[model samples]
Target chain A: MSAVWSITKKELVSYFTSPIAYIVIAIFILLSGFFFYSLVWWFNTQAMQMAQNPYYFQQININQMVFAPLFHNLSIILLLMLPVVSMRLFSEEKKMGTEELLFTSPVSVIQIILGKYLAALIVLLAMLVLSAIPTIFTFVHGNPEPVPYLLGYLGLFLLGAAFLALGIFWSALTENQIVSAVLTFGTLLLFWVLSWAAYSARGLWQDVLNYLSFFEHFDGMTKGILDTSDLVYYLSFAFFGLFLTHSVIQFRRWR
Target chain B: MIETEQLTKKYGDLVAIQNLSFRVEEGRIWGLLGPNAAGKTTTMRILTGYLPATSGRASVAGYDVFEQAEAVKQSIGYLPETVPLYPEMTVESYLGFVAEIKKVPAARKKAAVDRAVQIAGLQSVRKRLIRNISRGYKQRTGIAQALIHNPRVVILDEPTIGLDPAQIKEIRDLIKSLKGEHTVMLSTHILAEVKEVCDGVVIINEGKLMASGSLEELARSFSQNDGVYLKLDRADGEVLNLFRQLPGLKEAALDGAEIRLEWPWGQDLRTQVLKLCLDKRLEIREMRSLAMNIEELYLRIVSGGMEQ
Candidate 1:
């Protein structure tokens, strides 16, 4: 456990000391802030128009009108930004020959992988926390349901964790960070678009695609509904990606 | 402290090392001497638990390298051919991190780093970032990281590959100082380095062991006969003829003012030669045994001039 923490602390220090962490955080906050502003503006305009009619005004809630779109936009932003956060985790070690030091040390491979994975998760958490600033405005000016609002951020965190794990696996595949990032982005985009193909498919194929799509699992937590299956899906997806990373590292050692 | 038996590694059909075996006793410095692509790094990697051997066994500090890798790693320190360092970290922080992962206790981690810094002579640049330090300091930092945990065996692959002569001497001196407490196995292609620092040598070429012994032992084993040189004040054909009369003389030659004579191994003719020179009224200037240096021994072994 101390070995794992040592690796984690060193990785965290490296992440913050380099320009990659700041640049990634800056871009995520900027995009999420813009999305929040536009969504809230559109929500205000729709609320004004709906207030004249009682039936339409009943449908206007802050959770669905403003926060839901913002959460969805933040997920997209995370999908793009988290790969950059994870690209250097293993790629830089291999490129700089530091993997030799790491492997020759007494620490296990799982500890090293978990250390890097947790560092990326921490960066993802930081970005999520910073993006919550715009949501705080809704809490102060209007009464947004705190439960669903917090759940939406929970969904986003789980989604980002899954994306970061896959990114780490891709990073472990190659020494070139660019290639790792591109492969991660491409694989995540494929999983993101799986639901689009599900719409045209018939029978069990549609259900399988929907179940496999990240959008399906993340959609429920955006609202007030917290399904155990959705939580299990994200956690299992993360575990599978980490398992693949471990296999790759172990295979490389013997090869 | 370190031993390997028939350690072989094969990448598909290509052999990296085949039937390579050597032993490094505790508290002695051994040099792994070989040409480029001679499997020196591969052997060290296997011994350090960085890579697995295909069909052999290795042990470090009484732990099996493959079966008990973690235990072996805890007892060994390794520096690869490329000095692996985090360029963004200061030398002290880097050593601290190494000590942490190497499982130094929390209370002793700071003291471990301090001891390593003192031993590797890294105090001058301990606060400097690795990227900004000179190459010599960076190499020392690498050594410091390896020693931070105070492992029983230290394996350094080409530790002085790229340094100025002064820096090389400094690094060599540092390695020599590790003779009593640490069992060091350093790989180098420089023959002079082995001559200067190593107590014994393991020479490999083309992925096979050529020779392994002390410098004098290797020299004596490789040469067919023992030889001596005699410098005289006056030497002519008469002196050569006088030396040729000695029994059991394998060969004799006169060059310039010196006479070179060779006899079978284990033969001592020095007293006879001195008596002959004294009775002949010849003045002697300098006389010394002609033993092959490491350079000649390495060349002969690597070139396959002598049988393994």
Candidate 2:
């Protein structure tokens, strides 16, 4: 475990030494800020008459207006940002031959895999933390409930971890970082599009295919209902991706 | 110490190496001599735990490379055909990372890295990023990484492959200096480099062990009946008659002032030749045995194509 952490620490340092980390963080924050401002402007314009309807407005909760869109807009922000962090995790090392040094070291294979995974996870965590500015800014306009924000962040974290695992698995499959990035984006886009298809289906297939939707789990989180099944599903998804990555590593060594 | 028995590697239908066997004892530099695709690098990879043998066993530093790989890795430092290095890192940081991965004691890591830097003559480029350094410096950095942990055995695959003559001499001297402290096995196709540096030569050809012995011993075994060239102040016919008078002298050929003579094995023809020259009062300017050099011995072993 210490060996794994050591490698993770080294990878994090490597990220900072390169320009990829700052670029990913900058793009992520810029996109998140763009989404937050767009949602605020749209909601404020729609509820402009609430300024004069004092009686019903006082009775209505302002938290819904302030925090609801913040939670809703996070998915798209992450969809674009996560791949930037995860794309170069294994692909660049393979291209540079640094993977040989890592693999042949005294450290176990699990340590090397988990180290790369954790480095990308840390970068993601940093991105999520940066996106919290909008949630904090909601308190200036109106008293927003923190529960939904907390729940939304949890769902994003899990989703990001799952996406990162998929990215890492793809990174291990090839030596070209651009190919890894494009393929990861295509895969995540496929998943992102699946929820709409599942929702639009009219038959029993809709019920069956909806389980494959990442958005369905986000819906439960935004509603502040943390379903145990959703948590289990995301955890299993991440573990399955990691398992495939391990198999890829083992196959490289054996064959 | 190192030993291999019937070690083989095949890529598709092409065998990279096959049925190779040899033993390298401690306290000597063994040169693995073969052509570019002659499986020298493949054999080194198997010994260093980087690749597995297709059909045999290789043990290095008393650990079976396939079965006890971690142990083999711990005991050996391997420099691959391409010096696997991180070009983005400085020399100090690169060696530090090597020490960290090799698990040098925390208390001694800095000192070990320092010693390796000094030994490989990397002090000048210690603070420079590896990408900024020249190929010679990069090669030395590779050597420093291999020597960081001070493993019992060091295996270098074509360590001096791309260096200029001066850089090659520097690296050769460094390899020679590693003699008593570590058992070193280096591979090269340059015959002169092997003769100049290696205490023992192991020649392979077409993925098989052609011969293994000391340079002189291999030369003697492969080139048993050698000739002697005598340059003296004597006419061709007189020297031919003098050479024929000697009983064990097989044949004599004259080329201007030089007389070449071949003799049977274990014959003392030198004394007889000297006596004849003295009797004829021939002024002998030079009389020396023409033993086979490394190039001839390597060709004789490799092109002879014998399995032994």
Candidate 3:
């Protein structure tokens, strides 16, 4: 356990010292701010229209109108950007031959994968925390219930963790960081776009694809409705990704 | 102590190494001598538990590498050929990370890291980022990481391939200084490194064990038949005949003023030749002994194995 934590701690330090940490954090905060302001501006426009014409009042829920879109857009940004942090987890180690040091150490393969994943998760969580400042501003000025923001943050975190695990698996699959990043993006994009297939498909197939899509699972929480099934889905996705990562690591030594 | 029995590793249809067996006693510096693609690195990887053998077995300090890998890894420190290092990390932090994962007790972790830093001579640049350091310092940092936990066996693959003479000597001296406290096994194609530091050697060619033994013993074994160079002041065809006349001298070749006396490696014909020289009243300016050094032994053994 200490071995795992030690690896995690080292990885975290590695992230903090590297320029990538600052780059990713700055990009995320800037993008989240952009998404937040856009949602606020659109909501203000609708409110003005309603004020000018009483019949134009759409009876829109503020949480659903502003917080939901902001949460969803931020999740998309996190999906696209977290790969930068996660792509180097195992890929860079293999390229630089540092995997030799890692595997030859007293730590186990599972420990290394978990350590790297946890470290990426922690960094991603920090980025999320910073990105949430805009949401906090909304809670203060927009006068919406904090429940949606809190729930949406939880949803975003789980979604980020699941994506990070997937990125870790791809990183372990290849030594090229570019390849890992591209594959992670493509895979996450596929998950992001699965709703399209669900929308066009027949009943049973649509239901299955909708259930499998990450956006579907994350949607319930972002809308301020907590579901055990959604949590189970993310936990399972993360576990499956981590399990595959472990197998890649184990097979790498044999090969 | 380290031991391997009939170890084999195959990549697809290609065998990286096969039927390899060797042993190193506790607290001895052993060298793994081989040419490129001779499986030196592969064998080290296996013994260090970075890779598993396709067949056979290896044990380090009473722990089977495959069965008790964590214990073996815990006890052995391995520096791969490329010197696995994180360029973004500082030398001290890298060693500290190694110490933590290597299970150096938390109480002694600082002391252990400090000892390794001192031993590897990384004090001045301990706080500098590894990428900002010179290649020599990077190599020293690699050595420091491997030695941080004071493991019983430290395996180094080509520890001094591209260093300057001074750095090579420093690394060699550092390895030599670990004599009784650590069982060190270093791999290299440089015979001079083995001659200078290793207590014993294991020579492999094309993934197969060719020869292995104590330094002097290995040299003498492969050097069974050698040539003696003789420079005579009264040098001529007559001297060549004089050299050939000595019984047990297999053949004689003339090169400028020197008469080359070819004989079996174990045979010492100096006394017989000196007596014959006195009888003939020949003025002997220089007589080279008919014994093989490590270079000749390595060339002969490697070439001999290649031919077979």
Residue B162 of model 3: what lDDT?
A: 95
TM-score of each: 0.95, 0.89, 0.90
Give me the candidate number with maximum TM-score. Answer: 1
Best by DockQ: 1
A125 Cα displacement, candidate 2 (Å): 1.8
Question: Fraction of native Cα contacts kept in each candidate?
Answer: 0.82, 0.26, 0.87
Candidate 3 global lDDT:
0.89
Q: lDDT tens digits, residues B1-308, model 2?
A: 99999999987688999999998889889999987789998888888776777889899989998898888888888787778777767889888878887778778989999999999999888999888999999999988888999999999989999899999999999999999999999999988899888999888988989999787677667655667889986657866886787887788888667888887556657887888889888889898776787888887788878767
DockQ scores of all models, one per candidate: 0.83, 0.45, 0.70
Tens digit of per-residue lDDT, candidate 2, span A18-127 = 88888888887887788778777776775676757877567544446645566667777777767777888888888877776666566777778898899889998888
lDDT per model, in order?
0.91, 0.83, 0.89
Question: What is the lDDT for B19 in model 2?
Answer: 93
Cα deviation of B287 in candidate 3 (Å)?
A: 5.4
The DockQ ranking, best first, is 1, 3, 2
Comparing 2 with 3 on TM-score, the higher-scoring candidate is 3
- Per lDDT, the best of the predicted structures is 1
Model 2 chain B weakest 10-residue run by lDDT: B218-227
